[model samples]
Target: MSPTTKNAGGDRAGGLRGELTPRRITALAAAVIALVFVFENTKEVEIRLLIPEVTMPLWLALLAVGVVGVLCGVLLVRRRG
Candidate 1:
């Protein structure tokens, strides 16, 4: 191979070498566990607010809350940064 092509391939391989570290593996495992937890609780339940009530599957409610919490966290971080 030419020197230019060899250098390019090495750079690309180096960029990907550290893509999966211990911390990333742990985060992936945690995400899988969270998904399992969300799917297992499939019962319906009542959710009460100030003046209204709603019935939905337990997993859906939990997933919504999780999404909202993540959005709030991202917003706070962005504001701080």
Candidate 2:
């Protein structure tokens, strides 16, 4: 193919490579940071609810809260979109 001719294969590859855009990079960084935070905080703590107190590893509690936050964000975005 001549340099001036558009390459369909090149275009497809570029599209795939562009998948890791800034937003994705930021999300990935956030996930890594959250993981590190959870790992660093492994001590047990008390979580008191309305009726009872539960004790678990701090990492587990943080992970659970992060999952819930992600789910809420997804639901809100879907509803708005």
**Model 1, runs deviating above 4 Å:** 1-18, 79-81
Clashing pairs in 1: none
What's the lDDT for residue 11 in model 1? 61
What does candidate 1's lDDT look like per residue over 1-81, in tens digits? 765666534665655466688988996898788889999999999998678999999999889998898789888878641
Question: What are the root-mean-square deviations of the candidates from the true structure over C-alphas?
Answer: 5.2, 5.3
Please list the residue runs of candidate 2 whose C-alpha ends up more than 4 Å from where it truly belongs after superposition. 1-18, 79-81
Clashes of 2: 0
Number of clashing residue pairs, candidate 1: 0
Show pairs that collide, candidate 2.
none
Top of the candidates by TM-score: 2
Judge candidate 2 against the unseen true structure and give its global Cα lDDT, from 0 to 1. 0.87
What C-alpha lDDT do the candidate models reach, one value each? Answer: 0.83, 0.87
